[model samples]
Target: MSVLAHLGVEITSSTDDSMDNRKRPAASPNSGSFVFWSSSFRRQPARVLIVEALPPWWSDTCTVLCDALDNFLSLACNLDGPSRIPLLSLYAVSRQQECVLPFVQVRGNLARLHSCVEELRSIPGEGCIKGAARGGELLRQAVLDSLQQFKQYIRHISTGNQTNNNLSVEITVVTSQPGPGIVRQLEMGLKDADLVSLKRLLVVQINSVGDWGQDTPSPETTYTEAEESLMLGTEVELLRMENSVFALETMLKAWLQEQGGDREHLHLLLPSPTDSPNPVCVKCDMQERLISPALIPLTPNLGVKTESVRDFLPVTKASANQNQPPQRLKVIKLLRADGLCESVLYGLPLVIRPTTCWQLDWEEMETNNNLFHALCHTLRGRDLFLLLQVEPAGGSGVYSHYVLQSSTSLSLLLKPVVSRELLLPCSMPVSPQDPVPDAMQTVQCCLTQLDEEFVFNPLSLTNNLYQHLKSRGLISQPRYPYRLQPAAVLRDQSQPPEGAKTTGSRQPRQVKPHSFLQQCEGHEVT
Candidate 1:
């Protein structure tokens, strides 16, 4: 049975089965998707119940949802590992039908702590839905394990040699594809306020050229960096990060190669400073000076307290989407997971915002005209970053059981909502393998990004229930992207005009005005 059916929904098995998962109509174009209950009322700390009667497929969505939490989706092993983590994790839970997402409740060890909001928000104005759902089973499993393992890796703070009772972990996810801020928060969670022991590990699997091209896997060892380094590193990467997967992958490979390319994804693990490694590097004054500026130090006599430790918070992780082929899926998923909101590790719904960026395949565009033409022509020639939201239509024939759930009205959790900055942009980097840049620098060399759209759940007013719920709205009325993208500083050249400079910096520096023809004061002065 499905989670929805358990909650009083009625969907047929054959109709909602895997065989019918496909045939569903294309989702909206100018839409972005985020997860929230489609039911009414945004009551505080409500428990999300997946009942026994819930349909079998309902959990599928949750399964997918959990995998995407915190952008820690399934990623390939080192481009050359022993077969990419097999791409998945599947488990049968006892009462997952009642799997709970308590928004307003965090008691016991977490009573005094402030409520943290974990949102899977959108990037500026766009989203990456439908296709992402197509990641299917293999990718799903990998994503699950990675997330669980990550949860286990998030602990940075020592509970002061206290008992396990004193240890508890809590995290919140924000969206907008955060670069460094999210890392900072995790480091903060695991370190001292002064960020003396920023033990949060940061591993990056940069996007790579086609076929991953013999790149080494990141190390499997755990890592931790101090606040100063974490913050600086965050700023540098976030500001200088390219939307390009290849670039990211390459940089990571280079760093990992130094530590021996034996681990996966060329992982860069920063261990707690207090722990002893080889003392040779620390004794080198020049080396110390070089690294000291980039890294902060941990307190003396430090030890890894197992109890208070949080799960592994990946500085970055990747997962391949099944529907779009492994390669494309890998790139887009990371793009979706770049923000603070997209950083969940375990079964937590860190940031449930809409998908802001999308990676689309050309042929797929033909199925949906609104999105097709929208991509063909900007909104009034306005190339703003737009988000497309989509809900997959499931069931038999054209209309399937999945369709009903996707089309169903929005829940209170989705309404009465407040969100900002969940903007959109193509994740393709302007340049591949470029060095870091300043805070405001952008690699605008490449302007074309995938033009895609998704579903838009239409909001409806209850017969007479709307008045009382005026402040909040129902997340209903599903619509697809007629067009996606809002105007932005980044130019979209996918549909550039004839003779237009197809590829180059959009904002060329103003060259000083020079004389059209400097008179040569040579021997024959003209």
Candidate 2:
């Protein structure tokens, strides 16, 4: 027998013997074995240490530094797993050069760390009392000292008899002006460390001030160093802090992409707009309230929810007639799976008169319109189809459907009836002697198939269709209605005409327009 079956037989025999033995009173010696096995499978929580370089001369240094620390703490509070009690440490780079290194200042406990961050917030306002001649260089050394302290802490935790060695470690440096000296010192410190396994070394640069001169490193230099760090298998990123919510969200998304943990279970907490005693809880409440409406059922059948689709109607002026109300058309909005609205319609006024049945002013539509370009950006790399419904001003239920496809550019797809019969016939070869009425007859046939209530003018539709065909290069421009270009003709030149003279060698025959239609019948219009 195979090893698996033999093992299964042994397990069955053991279970049978245990069941028999349970009838007789015995000591429960192995009952706790299952608990021990499960304990071994549980994962140890990760510990993250954040070291920030806060200079006294920087503008709004305290506010920026406090905000970043608060943001990191908020993220820690939202982490998943019962054992995931995240340890966060924050240190402010000092300007004074001291002989003794600063201790592992912040502890792992959340309450204690919160108090430490609150204490550091006041340093920016008071300013550094004893400033060193080379402050940047001193700050760099302080950061290295902090890293060494963190490594010692990791070693101490792992060496304990009762401690779990599965814990991961990460170090993040937050700074506004990171000079080359700081970068070199950090690289050397990380390279020399062999005892601790560093998960990630992140450098976050907050650009609160607009000045890019002497104090701040240039973009090219920062990019080159970041690239080198990545090649060495270190996770490094430089983030510019922006006030806009959209910009901040984009930055966080890029950071999340590099994370090695489970993204679905991970939660990122940002600072609340308003100052609150408990900012993390306030932020969570605001998010739930904002997204609650989208979760509600808006349809009667509970088939389609508000989160999946939305609808809008154009604002119209009051009607003059007291007997009836002005007509309003429904515009349906559909969202992609990623919760992004791909298209939105702007309700423009429609003009109706005896001369012009029911038409929208193209000039007015183009004046203050940017929705098309915005849609292109939102729906990039995806195909978008818009179904426009144009209804008459009266109480009539009839409406026309116009399909528009939008991509890098927009195009109008002629209705199936118009394309197959009218537009296709116009491009087909015609005899030079025949009048253009033959093609016009095909358009008339298509018109008969359309609804009688369709308000668009036949002449206008024909002209627009012809222009669209010309732009797509389906047919040459009409010099004359019946004139045919040589390129448009197709004929089989294998045999000569019955009355034509035959020479010793065969010669190419001139193509006639009448015979071209037979060859082009199989061509399909895009």
| Regions of candidate 1 where Cα sits further than 4 Å from its true position | 1-180, 192-200, 203-239, 251-526
Which candidate has the highest lDDT of all?
2
How high a TM-score does candidate 1 get?
0.16
Candidate 1 C-alpha lDDT tens digits along 304-361: 1111212112111334332321211011111121221221111211111222235645
Runs in model 2 lying further than 4 Å from the true structure: 1-53, 78-85, 96-110, 125-139, 159-167, 178-181, 188-196, 210-237, 243-526
Worst 10 residues of 2 by lDDT: 1-10
lDDT, candidate 1, at 197:
19
Candidate 2 local Cα displacement, residue 227, angstroms: 16
How far out, in Å, is residue 204 in model 1? Answer: 7.4
Q: What's the TM-score of every candidate structure?
A: 0.16, 0.35
The sequence of per-residue lDDT tens digits that candidate 2 reaches over residues 1-526 is 0001100000011221211223433323342111111111123223343434345444345565555555544443332212222234445655543322222322223465566667666555434433222444554455455556656665675675545433555555555554343454455444444424556556655555534346444332244555455432453444455533333333332321112233233233433323333323211110000111111112221111111112122223445443233333234443332441212111111221112223447665554245545654454456444444445323333233333333344322211001100010011246778647954554455445446654445455544766787787645545443444454343533355788877877654555556555456665333
